[model samples]
Every structure is written in C-alpha cells, then in structure tokens.
Target: MLIGIPKEIKNHEYRVGMVPASVRELIENNHEVIIETNAGIGIGFSDQDYIAAGASIEDTAAAIFAKADMIVKVKEPLAVERAMLRQGQILFTYLHLAPDLPQTLDLIDSKAICIAYETVIDTQGRLPLLAPMSEVAGRMAIQAGAQTLEKSNQGSGMLLGGVPGVAPAKVVIIGGGMVGNNAAQMAVGLGADVTILDRNIDTLRSLNIQFGSKVKVIYSTLDVLEAEVLAADLVIGAVLIPGAAAPKLVTRDHISKMKPGSAIVDVAIDQGGCFETSHATTHQDPTYIVDEVVHYCVANMPGAVAKTSTFALNNATLPYIIKLANLGYKKALENDQGLLEGLNVINGKLTCKSVAEAHNLPYVTAKTALAI
Candidate 1:
C-alpha cells in the first residue's frame, strides 16, 4: 500500500502525521510512503530525515494528494486538501465532523473511506486515539490558562500557584475524564486549589481517591457548576461526548457573572465547546475577552507542542496504520471491532451514528455501508 503524509496546514499546527521513525516502520513492512517536502520540518525532522527512513518526498502537497492509497494527516483536511480527496481513498485522521457541517458535506460528496481517529475505540470502550492528544491538551490547558491570567493578556493577573504568603489560585476543571484528570494533575502539582466536577459518581470517587486531600472532586450539577465557575480564577472546560458536540455547560450568563480578569481554557473547543462564548482561536491570537472573562479556546492546543504531540500520537496510531496498510482497510476494519468504530464515512454513506445525528442525516451501520 502507498501511504501519504501531508504537511498540516491548520493555523499554528506543526505536527506531522508520520515521523521519520514511523515511516521506517512502514517501509520495513514493505509499504511505500510519500510525504510532502518538509512536512516534519517544524517538528525538527528534515526532508533528509524522512528520505533516510525510506520515504519519498514530494515537492508539493498536490502530488502527495494525487497518488497515495491512504492519506495520513494530523488534523482535519482544510478546504483545499479536502477538495483533493479521491473517492475510496482512506483518510485516517482527527476529523471532528460533528461541529463542522461544511466538512461533513464535503466528505460525503468525496465518497472516501473516512476513518476518524477521534472516534476509534479500544477493547475497554475508551477512545485510545483521542486520549494521547487529550492528555497533551489537558496539561497545556493549565499552562495556557496561567499565561492568560497575566495582566498583559487582559487576565485577572492572579498567579496559578500563588506565593507562600498569598492564597493559591482556584482552578476548576469540568469533567473527570482523561482531559480533566490530566489538568487536575498539573494544577495540583503547581500547588493550586484544584477542583474537578463530573456527573459520573464512579469517576468522581476515583478522582477523590486519586487526589485525596490535595484536590476536591464533586458531583456535577447546574448549581454546583455555577458556583464553581463564579469562584474560580481559572476554569478549564474539559468535558467530552465522544464523537458528538460538547455540551455547553458554561453559559454566556456564567461568563458575565465571573470575576473580571478570570480566564477560561476551553480544551473541548475541538468538539465545538463546553463554554458558550468559546470560539476556536489560533496560537498566533489565542485569546479573546468575553464579558471581562479571558477565553483560551485554541482548537488544536496540542499543536503548540508539536514534537511531543507528534511522537505521542504516532506511538498510538502507527500500529493501526500498519494494519490498514498490510491487511487493507476493509479487512482491517472487519477484523477489529474497535477499528470499525473509527469509520465515519465510506462509499458516500455515513457510518458514524454520532456524526449522522449531529447533522440529522441518514445513517447506516459500518457493516451495512460495506455490505459485509
């Protein structure tokens, strides 16, 4: 199989789909790999690096798009790259289609085998592919929110872990999943007053056990959420609903009533956002003021740490890529129930029920779509 890796074109996105070592693994499997020239350059892997790993480099993304059997990418293809998609070409990437209607429509028209990394499941029913990035984004949320708290950024100017003589900042994280858990870990390590809220009693219990007296874990309810946001110096929106749009837990009214200079990091911005006022921002301009509350809602937060993110993501995705290349997508998807969950679109049909319900479109089971 011929696999292609295109340089990520999203704003401030520097991670490559496949690194040199990842390419070498595919090459050893007798697969041909092509990458756009300098695709890994931002992550410090030069074109020569990929070449040395047995990958052919193309001068333009157009050429890579024109030929490869499968297009491995780091982010959802932008408009231009989406236009280049060929029917039946395997697109294995993070396609957060639930919130982007135009992308969903374009993908349907392309009739490609769209395997979304974000929706892929593991044997334990966990999102294995999405977890790595979630971990990165979650940890970064604290870093970004702390920066946003500086007076220079129009934030409330509160230090995350205040001086010994001063009280530590109050950090409130919504959701107790991977993102929330990681965020809480960072915040607690910084000696901040950290609190995590979730609807799942078991998750809350687990978090309580994990943090003990160092952090607070609470049951999530409307009143509890409102109270926490009003008191928090930094609020991290980390909730997720698998492939569906994130629920808007923090309303506009919640933003207005928050103390002036307070900051919010909406880590769930990729799946729409849990905060009503959150809009996707780029690293170049990563914040906006909403009712005196600073909003940090970069959709690709992990992209800010390109090298770490690329390597971590590659570690998780490479085995699946190998399977698709060696066994062919159909056989691979058929053999792995978890991989079949990754199928969003194939042969012009919507195979992901979440995406179909998001757009109120017709849906078919992956098996039905493939006539397996």
Candidate 2:
C-alpha cells in the first residue's frame, strides 16, 4: 500500500500528518510512503529526514493525492484537497463533520472512505485517537484564557493566581472529560479557584477524588451552569459530544450576564462549541468580544504547539495507520470494532449515525456498508 502525507493547509496549522519516525515504521513493514515536499517542515522535519527514513518525497499535493492508496493527514482535508479525493480512496484524519455541513457534503460526494481519528474508540470506550490532541488543547485552553484576561486584551485584568491578600480568579470548566480534567489541572496549579461541572456523577466523583478539595466538582444543571458561568473570571468550554455538535451550554443571555472583560476559552469550538456566541477563529485573530465577554474560539488550539502535537498525535495514530495500510481498510476495520467506529463515510454513504443525523442524511452502518 502507498500512504501519502500532505502538508496541512488550514489557517496557521503547522502539524504534519506523518513524521520521519512514523514513515520509517511504515517502510520497515514493506509499505511505500510518499510525502509532499515540505510536508513536515512546519514541525521541523526536513525532506532529507523523510528520505533518510526511506520515504519518497513528491513535489506536489496533487501527485500525492492522486497516486497514494491512502491519504494520511493531521487535519481534515480543506476544500481544494477534498476536491481531489477519489472514490474508494482512504482518508484518515480528524473530521469534525457534524458542525461542518459543507465538508460532510463534499466527503459524501467524493465517495471516499473517510475514517475520522476523533471518532475511533478503544476497548475501554475511550477516544484513543482524539486523546492526544484533546490533552494538548485542554492544557492550552488555560494559557489562552490567561493571556486573554490581560487588560490590554480587553479582559478583566485579573491574574489567574492572585498574589497574597488578593483572591484568585474563579476558573469554571464546563465538562469533566479529558479536556476538562487537563484544564482543571492547569487552573488548580496556578492557584485559581477551580470548579468543574458535569452531568455524570461518576465523573464528578472521580474528579472530586482526583483533586481532593483543591477543585470543586459540581453536578451540572442549567441553573448551576449559568450561576458558575456568571461568577467565573475565566470560563473554559471543554464540553464534547463525540461526533455530534457540542451542546450550547452557555447561551447569549449567559454571556450578556457575565462580568465585563471576563474571557471564555471555548475548547469545544471544533465541534461547534458549547458557547452560543462561539465562532471558529484562527490563531491569527483568536478572540472576539461578545457582550463585553472575550471569546477565544481557536478551532485548532493544538496547532499552535505544532511539534509536540505532531509527535503526540503520530504516537496514537501510527498503529491504526499501520493496520490500515497492511490489512486494508475493510479487514483492519472488521478486525477492530473500535476502528470501524472511525468509519464515518464510505462509498458516498454516511456511516456515522451522529453525522448523518446532524444533516438529515441517510445513515448506513459500517458493517452494512463494508459488506456491500
């Protein structure tokens, strides 16, 4: 099998799909890997690095897309890249399709085998592929929020960890999952008053045990969420709903009621965001004010830290990529139920129930689709 790696083209996206080490692993398995010229340059891997690992470097994305059996990418293919997708070709990447109707439509029309890294699950029912980036985003959320809170950035001019005789800023996280956990870790480390809200009692209990009174774990209800948001100096929207759009837990009314100059870091912006005023912003211009509340909704938060993110992502995705290349998508997916869950679109059919339901499209089970 021929695996292709193309340079990510998203705005300010610097992470590469495959690193030199990952390419070497494929080569050791007797697979041919072709990477577009300068694909890994953003992450400090030179073309010579890939060549040293026995990868053939192509000069253009068109050639890589056209000739490769499977396309491995860090982010979802952009509009131009999506246009190049052929029927039956494999696309392995993060496809946040629920919130992006146009991308979903394009993928459906391309008739490609789209396996979303974010949707893949492990035996423990954890999102293994999405974990690394989620962890990065979660940690970065606090950093972004802290920066946004500076007075020059139109924020409340409050330090996350206040000095002696000054009370620390209140940090409220909207979920108790991976993103929330990491955010809480950062917030608590900085001596802020940290609180996490979630509907899952088990998760809340787990958090309570993990922090042991350092962080407050609250049962999330609408009233409780609103109250927490209103009191927070920095609100981190870390909610997720797998392949579905993130629920808008913080409404416009809530934002309006928030303290002036407070900041919101919507880490769930990739899944359409948990905040009603959230819109996907780029690193170039990462924040916007809504009702005097600063909104930091950079959709690709992990991209800002390219080298670490690329390596971490490659660690989690390489095994699955190897499986797909060696056994083919059908056999590899059939062998692993979790991998099958990654199959969102195959042969022009939407195989993800959440994605199909999001757009009112017909849903086909992965098994049924593959069987055909």
Candidate 3:
C-alpha cells in the first residue's frame, strides 16, 4: 500500500500527520510512504530525516495525492485540499464533521473512505485518538485562561495562584472527562479553588474518590452550572460528545451572568462550542469579549505547541495507521472493533450515527458500512 502524508494547511496549524520514525516503521512493514515536501518541518522533523528513513518525498500535495492509496492528516481538509480528494481514496484524520455542513457534504460527494480519528473507541469505551489532544488542550486551557486574566488583556486582573493575603481565583470546569480532568489537575496544582461538574453520577463518584476532597465534584444541573459560573473567575468549557456537536452548556444569558472580565476557555470549539458566544478563533487572535466576559475558543489549541502536539498525536495514531496500511482499511476494521468505530463516511455514505443525525442524513451502522 502507498501511504501519503500532506502538510497541514489550517490557519496556525503546524502539526504534521506522520513523523520520520513512523515513516521508518511503515517502511519496515513493507509499505511505501510518501510525504509532501517539508511536511514534518513544523514538528521539527527534517525532510532528510524522512529520506534517511527510506521514505520518498514529493514536492507537491497533488503529486502525493495522485499516487498514494491512503492519506493521513492531522486535521480536517481545508477547502482547497477537500477539492483535491479522489474517489476510493482513504482519508484518516480528525474530521469533526458535525458543525460544518459544507465540508460534510463535500466528503460525501468525493466518494472517499473517511475514517475520523475522534470517533474511534477503545474496548474501555474511551476515545483513544482524541484523548491525547484533549489532554494537551485541557492543560493548555488553564495556561491560556490565566494569561487572559491579566489586566493587560482586558481581564479581571486576578492572579490564578494568588499571593499571601490575596484570594486565589475560582476555576470551574464544565465536564469530568479527559479534558476537564487535566484542566482541573492544572488548576488545583496552582493552588486555585477548582470545581468540576458532570451529568454522570457514577463518574462523579469516581472523581470524588480519586481526588479525595482536593477538588469539588458537583452534579451538573442547570442551577448548579449557573451558580458555579456566577462565582467562577476562570470557566473552562471542556464538554465533548465524540462525533456530535458539543451541547451548549453556557447560553448568552449565562455569559451575561458571569462576573465582569472573567475568562472562558471553550476547548470544545472544534465541535461547535459549548458556549453560545464562542466562535472559532485562531491562535493569532484567540480571544473575544462577550458581555464583558472574555472567550478564548481557539479551535486547534494543540497547534500552539506544534512539536509537542505532533509527537504526542503521532504516538497514539501510528499503531492504527500501521494496521490500516498493512491489512487495508476493510480488513483492519473487520479485525479490530476499535478501528471499525473510526469509520465515519465511506464511499459517500454516512457511517457514524452521530454525524448522520447531526445533519439529518441516512445512517448506517459502522459494522454494516465496513461490510460494504
């Protein structure tokens, strides 16, 4: 099989799909790997590194796409790259299709096999591919929010880790999943008061047991969410629903209820934010004021740390990529249930139930889609 790695073209996106070591692994498995020129540069891997690893480098994305059977990417295809997709080709990437009707339609029309990394599930019912990036984004949310809280940034001029005789900031996290957990860990480590809310009672119990009174775990009801937001100095929106759009937990009215100059870091902005006022911002310009409340909702938060993110992402995705390349997507899906769950759109049909439901399209089970 011929595998292609293209340079990520999203605004402020610097992570590459594959690194030199991963290419070497593919070569060892007897697969031909093709990388577009300087594809690994953002991640600090040079073209010479890939060449030394026995991989071929192409000068253009068109050249790489023309010959490769499978295309591995770090992010969803942009408009220009979407136009370059070919029928019967394999696209393995993080395709958050719920929010973008145009991109979803384009993928279907292209008649390509689209396996979304975010939708893949492990036996433990955990999102393995999405977890790594979520961990990165979650930790960074606090760092970004703390920066935005400085008076220079139009924030409340409060310090996250306050000095003696000064009160520490109140940090409220909206979910108890991977993103929220990491964010809470960071906030608590900085000596701030942290509260995490979730709809799952059992998960909340687990969190309470794990944290052991260090942080507050509350049952997430509208009233509880409102109360927490009203008193919070930093609000981190970490809600996620896999392939579906993130449910809006913070409404415009809620934003108005927040204290003046408080900061909201919506980590779910990529899947349509959990805040009513949150829009996809770039790392260059990552904040906006809504009702005097600052919103930092950069869709690709991990992109800010290109080298770390690329290596972390590659570590999690390489095994699956190897399976897909060696056995072919169909055979690999047939062999591993985890890999089967990654199938979103294949040959122009919608396979992920959440994605199809999000757009009112016909739905097919992942099992049924793989059989085709």
The TM-score of candidate 3 is 0.98
- Write candidate 1's Cα lDDT for 1-372 as tens digits: 999999999999999999999999999999999999989989899999999999999999999989999999999999999999999899999999999989998999999999999999999999999999999999999999899999999998899999979999999999999999999999999889999999999998899889999999999899999999999999999999989999999999999999999999999999899999989999999999999999999999999999999999999999999999999999999999999999999988888888888899998999888774
For model 1 the local lDDT of residue 251 reads 98
CA lDDT scores, all candidates in order: 0.95, 0.95, 0.92
Model 2: residues >4 Å from true position, as ranges? none
lDDT of 3 at 28: 98
How big is the positional error of residue 176 in model 3, measured in Å on the Cα after superposition? 0.6
> Which regions of candidate 1 deviate over 4 angstroms?
none
Alpha-carbon RMSD, each predicted model: 0.7, 0.6, 1.0
> Per-residue lDDT tens digits of candidate 2, residues 1-372?
999998899999999999999999999999999999999888888999999999999999999999999999988889999999999999999999999999999999999999999999999999999999999999999999999999999999999999999999999999999999999999999999999999999999999999998999999988999899999999999999999999898999999999999999999998999999999999999999999999999999999999999999999999999999999999999999999999999998899999888889898899999999
Per-model TM-score versus the true fold: 0.99, 0.99, 0.98
The CA root-mean-square deviation of candidate 3, after full C-alpha superposition on the true structure, stands at 1.0
What tens-digit string does per-residue lDDT give for candidate 3 at 318-351?
A: 9999999989888898998987888988888888
lDDT of 1 at 320: 99
Candidates by TM-score, descending order:
2, 1, 3
User: What is residue 272's positional error in candidate 2, in angstroms?
Assistant: 0.5
- How does candidate 1 score on lDDT? 0.95
